[model samples]
Target: MVRPLLRQLLAMAIVGSTAGCLITDRVEFEDPENLPPLIESMAPPAAKVVRLDRTRSEDVSFACQVLDQNEEDTLDARAFLDFARDEAIRGVTEVVQSESDARRRSVTASFPPDLFARGCHVVEVDVIDGGAAGWDPGGQTRFRSVKEGVAKATATWFVLAYDSEGDPRADISLESCP
Candidate 1:
C-alpha cells in the first residue's frame, strides 16, 4: 500500500547499534525555557520535485541556499551542498560547489535532466559563519532526494553536531527553517 502526502522533513535516522533500526523522524525538542538550533533554511525543505515542461525544456534544479533561520531577513555567510553521494564525490553531479549568491546568501543550480534521471543523495551541507573568530564552522545537516522506487520524489533532512574534525557534540538541534 502507498499513500501520497506533502510534509516537511524535520528529523533524521539515528544510526546506532544500541538505538536499533526504524527510528522515528522527529526532533526531540526540550522545554520552552531552552533553545534549539535554528534551521536557517529560506524555504521549506522539499521532496525533490521533477519540474515539468510540456515543450520539453525543463531541467533538474536545486538551490543551495542559506539564511538566518531565526531571522529570514538576514543573510548567512557561505553554504554548500552535495546531492550525489554521502561519502565521496563521484563527479556524477556537482560537488562542494559554493552557492551562486554568497553575499546575498544562496546558490541556485540548474542541471540537465540526466542528473535527476540517475537520482542522487546528500553528502553534506555546511555553513561558514562568524562565531568567535572571523570565520567558524556553523553546523551540518544531511539531505537525500530519491528519484524512483518507493520513496521517489521524497526528501529527508537529518541533523548532526560534528565539529571540524568530525567529533560529535551535544548542544543544539535544529528542526527546520522558518
Candidate 2:
C-alpha cells in the first residue's frame, strides 16, 4: 500500500512539472517581419571641411540619427573613422543617446583633434536593432538579427593643413604622410 501511495505521489509531481512548462506567460513572441534600423541623417555632412589649428586642440564630433520601425526594439549606434590609405583611427568612442522612445536614437562619436592629421578621413556610422525578430524564452532573451537589422552611413572629413602662424591653408590634398 505504501509503494502504491509513493508511486501516485511521484506521478502527481511529474504532471505538475509538465503543466508548468505549458504555461508560457513569460515567453515573448516577436514578429518575423521586423524591419531593420534606418539612418535618417548624420551631422557634419559628407565631404565636410574642418580647419584645425595645430597648436590648439578640439574634439571632432560625429553624430547620427537612427530610426527603427519596431518601437519596442532597442537600438545601438557606433561610429568609426578610417583614413583613405586603409589605416583606421583607434580610441574613438561612440556614444548612443536615446530619447524617451526606443524607436529613435542619437549617436555621437568623437576623437581628439590630435588623433587625426591633415588628411581625408572616412567616418562611418553603423546602427543595429536589438534583434527582436526571434522569440524570447522565459528566462532570457535571444538575439537573431545578426544581418537583418543593421544600417550604415559614411561621410568624409577633410582636415585642412595649418601654417606656422596657426592659419588654415587651402590644401585639399588627401595625403596624411610625407
- Candidate 2: the clashing residue pairs are none
For residues 2-70, could you state the per-residue lDDT of candidate 1 as single tens digits? 222222221223333246566678989864331212223422254332222222345434444443222
lDDT of 2 by residue, 81-166 (tens): 55335433343334354667666767777767666555444555545564322212232211211343343333334555353453
TM-score of candidate 1 to 2 decimals: 0.27
Poorly placed runs, candidate 1 (over 4 Å): 1-39, 42-58, 68-104, 118-125, 130-178
Global lDDT of model 2: 0.54
Listed in order, each prediction's TM-score against the native is 0.27, 0.53
After best superposition, candidate 1 residue 25: deviation in angstroms?
Answer: 51
